[model samples]
Target: MGIVLNQSLKNTVITYLGFGIGAINTLYLYPVFLGATYYAVTNYILSAANVIMPLFAIGMQNTLVKFYSQCKTEEERGRFLSFTVLFPFLLCIPIGIIGLFFFDDLVYFVSKKNPVVQTFIWLIPFTGLCMAYFEIFYAWARVHMHSVFGNFIKEVGLRLFSLFAIVGVYFNWISIVDFVYVTSGIYFLALIVTMLYAFKIKRPNFQFYIPANVKDILEYTFYIILSGSVANLLLDGDKLMLNQYLVIENIAYYSVATYIALVISVPSRAMHQIVYPITAKLMHENKYEELNALYKKTSINLQIVGGFVMLCIFVNISQLYEIVPKEYSGGIIVVFMIGLSKYFDLILGNNNAIIFNSKYYRTVLFLGLFLVLITIVLNRIFIPLYGIMGCAFATLLSITLYSLAKLLFVVKRMHLYPFTKETVTSLIVTAVLFLAFYFWEFPLYPLIGIALKSIILTAVYLYVNYKLVISKEINDIIDKMLLKFKLRS
Candidate 1:
């Protein structure tokens, strides 16, 4: 437990630091240098690529994680990796052929009103293929418990490359069309680097196995594809829908707000990376008690961390928007709404991981499909009426319902609940801190206002936690750090 906590904390710090750099690049630098329309085009293209990548992947990224752990020998695992890599290319060719046939119609349908977006639609399939291979190789790396490098490449490396491309565009070294192509090229380069690293660690040997095991893999992959598609739709579908139904510049505004809100999920993302493998191993061994304890602890810790992040965003949202163009200030409401959705997701802890690794996974997929339909309907009804705010509302409603459904499913099927006294305490304290900082405005300068609000919020939240003693783990960590420093002195 101690080791998991320490490593989880360390990894969370690194992931968020990387995400912080990404936020700056997305929110401030991109908008400041490039206009909102250009920025929105970039976001829409990337989001489209992400939404398409899973189709080409054929769910191999997830299948690798589940099946790789089941293999008894390294050679078998290597063969599985080889198959996973080859499978995507096969799926991609047919999809690419179909895309080529419908390319003009699809572009016309999605971006008819905005020709700039239409111009960039060609980048989607190329970037999608690159993204598919990147995940396939990344999963191969994760199976070996080497996640840090792959994460670096996925999270930081690609963003850093795009940052440079933006610089090139700013300096007039390349036209906007070339800039977009360069962004797609970055993913291809990242895929190449990850593949080289994967082979260097364990060279894959291709073998044609009997189609018996392949059948089972395909069935699992089918369920995972449905599940993954719904999940992506829930996460990024709002932006895509906004791009289609609303104005193009609204996509930029919504994206900025979404970026701020999505930061609350960083802890969950980092924890899930470590938790998925651990949960899979535990479930394999029938270690339900250990899994239950992990569920509770992760929920509480994530809520605490995620709560603080949401607090920061909510408190400074006004000042944050003031830095951007006035047109983007409308995103303030979107940020608040989406921040709540992410916080709800955090409170569910490892519910998604547990269900995905359990026998009830198929049932979970059905629920996700239902939610996807709901998300689509809600977005359609609201986006036409309210634009970005409507999209935010749709997301908030869909995510809340989805999280609740998963929570109930876990409790009913597994006879385990993640809520505890600490959970209640954390929620109350967070709510009070949020209310206190949200309504009370300081008369200081903008920067000073943010600093003071942050300080006050942190002090109040920590004091409440200290008074209630909500987390013995956090106290122990603080004690250990102080002890080590004292001994060194």
Candidate 2:
């Protein structure tokens, strides 16, 4: 635990810093500098690229992590690394040729509702290609037991670069169109830097031989590619569908609101980094009792924390929208719906980790595919009717249904559930706080009003949770903090 904590702490800080920069860029800089039209264009291109990235990489990044340590000798290791780097060419070559031949048709298809996308269609695949290889190289560094540098490049480095690029646009050094190109080129730059760092860690031997376990490798890679696509689709597919059904500017509105809702998941994301390995170990040791306790603990704890974030955001969403452009404020409902979905997912803490480690992992793949299919169908049905709000509703429905499915599957398979009486209490507390504060605003500026309301809400919320002892783990944390303060005094 100590070693893992020490190693991961810096990376975690770097990741949060990146998210901070991204939030600023999404909330203020992009909308202010580029305006709605170009912001929509850039976001659409990136979202489309992300959705297709799994296809481009063919799952080589994860494959490298899973199989790298299996090599008994340098020769085998070199061959495996070489294969991971080169395998994507098998898909890239054909895709490139197809793109070359049918470029206009492809552009026309995607840009039917949003013709602004036509000129930038090529950047989608190019950016996806850069993202794919960058991950492969990052994985290369990880396999050599040097992950911090790569993580920095992926998290902080890219965002900082974008911060500079946006600043460049502000200074009239680059056109909005040029900013898009520059952003895509940043991925290429990240790839080259990561590749160089990987080489510095342990220079590649560039062996041209197939690994002896090529059969198993290919099988695993095939499974991963399909499974990986499910996540990317769930994350970005709505934006892509919006491009087809609605005007592009709506995508920018959706993106801004979605970013606000995304903050609700931060606690869950951070906890998972620490909990994943422990969950895996418990499963390996067949400690069913402890695993079940952990399942419930994580669920309740995350519900409490994430629910707080959701409440704050939901209550202050109007103020937040005030900080952004007027056109972006129409996504108020988008924020609520998306935030609700994320809150539901938050309460199912460690459910994903358990499923990924269990024997029924493959079964969940089919379930995930089912989820992706349902998401697409819902988006197609709803986006035409609701526009950005419709897309948010589709997302909310698909994710809630998918989360319920996962919960039931885990309960049925392992006889482990993440719910307890405390879970219900946590929900009630969250609801009460939200109802109490939602209409209570300070007659002040947006920032000051938000701060005052949030501080009052946090005080009341924590007091109630402490008095009721909603979670033993949380109570202990509070006790520790208080004890330290008393000692210092």
Candidate 3:
């Protein structure tokens, strides 16, 4: 927990900083500089690429995390690392060949409804391959307990670069089309730097000497591919479906709402970087008691942090939307629905690491596949009727069911649950703060109002959570910061 706390805090700061930059881009720059159509096109290309990223890497990222620690010797570890790198190419090559052969057909199918996508269709796989390897190497860093630097690159570096590129567009240094290319290139740059850092951590010996558990490795990798696809599909499939059903421009609006909601998930994403490898280690060593304790600790702590983020977003959602283009304001409902779904998942803590590393992972994969099917079906049914809001409804419903299933599966199979009395306490705190501050907006500028409310909310929220001691870890962090401030003064 000490190492987890230290690294998780750093990652959280880094993740939020990234999201801060992303908010500026999504809310202001993309809409102001690129306008609706190109903004939609940029988002669509990235989402489409993200949906296929799991297939391209063939789950090597997760496979690396799950299996890397099992290697007894450095030579053995090197061999496994080598295996992670080369194995993905086996599938990638054949897929690339097929994609190239049918490139025209692929373009026609993807761009049939919205031809703006036709020109950018080629970037999807290119960007997907880059994203795939970046995760693979990023896992390489995580397995060695060197997640912060990789996370900085992932959470901060990528967005920072995109900021520069978007600014270039605004300055007439690059056209919108050039911005699209720069966006894909930024992903490529992320992959390269992550690979370099991963190598610096443990220079790969580049041996194909397969581990004795090659069979188990392959089987896990296969299941991971399917499971990873399900996870990615759940996140990005909405955008892809939007591209299919609505004019490509609507995706920009939906992206804005989703970005605002995405801030709520930052704690989970940050914690997962350090927590996944640790969770895998615990499961590997059969530390059931420790694992269960971790489960509860992460659950409550994330709920407190994520609940704060949710409150900030939901309470100020109207103001946040006010700052964005009027066309994007239609997504207010989208934020609440999607934000609620993310909050549910956030309170589950390291539930994903538990399931993915557990023996019952295969069973959960089936559940995930079912959830994906439900998502597609729900989107198909709802998109035509309600448009963007319907897509949000479909997503909210699909994710809730999926999250609930995973919770039940963990409870039933492992007898480990993330909830404690603190769970209810955290929720109550969030609910109270939301109700109190939501309708009490200040009669000031939207930005200033958001700032003032956030300050008041933060002070009050932290004081209550500290008084109740919802998470000792969190309370300790607060106490330490206060002590530092007092000493500095």
Candidate 4:
């Protein structure tokens, strides 16, 4: 528990720091300097790359994690690692060939209004290839319980590189077209760094052998590919769809709103990095009791952290939009809708890790596919009528439905629930705190109003949570931090 707490705290710090830097890039620099159309191009291209990259990897990244724990010897693990490295390339060639032959058609179908998109269409395959290898290499590090470095490379390193690319574009050092290619190059560089470190830690030998267990590996990979692709679609498919149905500038507005809303998930993402492997190990040992306890604690912690983030965004959204162009202010509803959806997800806790690591994973994947189809249908129906707001509402509905299904599935199959008396208490306290701030009007200055409201919110929420004991883990962390500082003094 101590180790898990420490790792979660460390990862949370790094994750939020990365998000802080990324928020500047997305919220401030991109919209203020690049304008909406160029920003849309950047967002669309990246979203396209994310959606296509999973297909190129062919699920090897996930396969590596699942199989690494089951291997009986170092030799078997080495072969598994080697297979992960080689498999993505095999998948990439076919994708690249198809993308090359049908490049114009693809652009025409996706974004005919935005001719700039045609110039950068070639980057899709290149970026997808880089993303595929980066995930594979990062999974190699994750299997060995060295997640911090990979987290840095994936979250911070890539963002920092993109920051430089954005700066280059700002200074006219490069065209936006070159900036797109350079962003892809950064992913490849990060992949190489991950590979070097993975080798340094556990040098995988390239002696390929046909193990009897290879069949199981392939089977698991097949299932996970569907699961992974569906999950990717749920997260990234909307932007791609919007690119097709709407103007490119609208895509930029939606992307900015989505990014701001997504900041709430930083804690959930950070915790999952530590949770998945640990949950896998516990499941392997049949430690169901411990697993259930961890699940409840994780749910409470995520809710508390994620709730605060959502509150801050909801309260300060007006000020946040002030930092961007006035046209982007129309995305305020999109921010609230997506933020609510992510908040629901946070409260559900480690449901994803538990379900994915369980034997009931296939059922979960089926549910995911069903929800993806629902999301697509809703987006098609809504985007035509409501535009970006419709997309936001569709996302909110689809995600909430998907989360509920998973929650019910876990309860029925595992005889466990993430909710408790404390969870309800936390909700009540958060509501009261929000209402208190809602009624009190600060001055009209956006920055000052935001800062003042944030302070009041944080102080009141902490005081209420302390009195109510909303989370034992959070209480313990506060105590530990205070004690460490006292001791140092």
Clash pairs for candidate 2: none
Which clashing pairs does model 1 show? none
Q: List CA RMSD, all candidates.
A: 3.0, 1.4, 3.3, 3.1
Candidate 4 segments whose C-alpha is farther than 4 A from its true place: 1-10, 69-77, 144-146, 199-211, 273-293, 439-441, 476-489
lDDT of 2 by residue, 1-489 (tens): 565676588778878888898998999999999999999999988888888888899999999999999999887888888999887976799989988899888888998888888888889999999999999999998877777889889888998999899999999999999999999999999999999998888788875678888899889888898888999999999999988998889989999999999999988877998899999999999999999999999999999999888988998988878888898889999999999999999999999999999999888888989999999999999988888988999999999999999999999989999999999899899988888988768878998999988998889999999999999999999999989889433
**Candidate closer to the true structure by lDDT (higher is better), 1 or 3:** 3
lDDT of 4 by residue, 332-411 (tens): 99998998899998999888888888888888888888998999999999998999999999999999998999999889
What is the C-alpha lDDT profile of model 3 across 1-489, one tens digit per residue?
587688878888887788888888889888888988999999999999999999999989989998988899888888899999988987799999999999999888888889989888889999999999999999999999988998899888998999999989988999999999999999999999999999999877885666789899889888988988988898899999998888999999999889888888977876787789889999999999999999999999889989998999899999978877788889999999999999999999999999988888888899989999999999999999999999999999999999999999899999998999989988888999899999989889999999999999999999899999899999888878889889433
> Clashes in candidate 3: how many?
0
Error of 2 at 315 (Å): 1.2
| Residue ranges of candidate 3 with Cα displaced over 4 Å | 1-10, 68-80, 140-146, 196-212, 270-294, 463-489
- Per-model tally of clashing residue pairs: 0, 0, 0, 0
lDDT of each: 0.84, 0.90, 0.91, 0.83
The number of the candidate with the highest TM-score is 2
- Residue-level lDDT of model 1, residues 72-143, one tens digit each, is 777777677778888778777888799889887898888876777877788888888899889988888877
